[model samples]
Target: MTTPADTTAPPPRRALTAFAWFWVGAPLCWGLYELGVKAAQLFTG
Candidate 1:
């Protein structure tokens, strides 16, 4: 029922999905934490 193209499509997509999540989430979380720390410093000082 399936073709060669169909079988190849999912693996690359799965790999890319995992890569994108790690790449985007790590920096976003770090930026949020850094911003929070800077905000606290401004308020306290």
Candidate 2:
């Protein structure tokens, strides 16, 4: 019988993608939090 193809990405590539997303997402989350807090303060102060 013939073997099937390995269609998924390699481990190193997956790790790199995850690491890149973490770096990209973390700052966006922090910036959004900061904006939310500033807006709250502006309305309440």
Mind giving the per-residue lDDT tens digits that candidate 1 earns over 1-45? 333674544444667778999999999999999999998988898
How many backbone clashes can be found in candidate 2?
A: 0
Q: Give the clashing pairs for model 1.
A: none
| lDDT against true structure, model 1 | 0.80
- What are the models' TM-scores? 0.50, 0.57
**Would you list the C-alpha lDDT of every candidate in the order shown?**
0.80, 0.80
Most TM-score-accurate candidate: 2
- The sequence of per-residue lDDT tens digits that candidate 2 reaches over residues 1-45 is 233458554345667778999999999999999999999988898
Worst 10-residue lDDT window for candidate 1 reads 1-10
lDDT of 1 at 8: 45
